[model samples]
Target: MELPKDPAMLLSIVNMKLRDFYPTLTTLCEEMEIKETELTERLASIGYEYDADGNQFV
Candidate 1:
C-alpha cells in the first residue's frame, strides 16, 4: 500500500493499523516498511505522539 503523503494522515492510518491489525511496534514497522523513529518523528512534527502501551497516536 502507498504511504500517506500527509504526516497527519499517515499517523492516523498507522494508529488504525496498530489498533485493528498489528499487536506491536516491531510488527507494525516491519509490515509497513517504516522505521519506528522516522514514523514517530514525522507524527510528532504534526503534533502526534505515539503511546507505546496504547499503541496509538495521540
Candidate 2:
C-alpha cells in the first residue's frame, strides 16, 4: 500500500492500523511491508512516537 506522504496523515493512519489491526509496531511494519525505523522516524519528525504500552503513537 502507498503510505501517506504527509507526516500528520501518516501518523493518523499508522496509529489507526496499530489500534485496529496490528498488535505491535513491528507487526504493523512487517505486514505492511514497511521498515519500522523509517516509519518511526517519519512519525517522530512530526513529534509522534510509538507508545508500545498503548499500541499507538503519541
lDDT by residue (tens digit), candidate 2, 1-58: 9999999889889988988999999999989999999999998998888999999999
Off by over 4 Å in 2: none
Per-residue lDDT for 47 in model 2? Answer: 88
Report the C-alpha lDDT of model 1 over 1-58, residue by residue, as the tens digit. Answer: 8778899789778988999999987799998788889888888898888788998888
> Candidate 2 overall Cα lDDT vs. reference?
0.92
What TM-score goes with each of the models? Answer: 0.85, 0.96
Per-model tally of clashing residue pairs: 0, 0
Q: What are the per-model C-alpha RMSD values against the true structure?
A: 1.1, 0.5
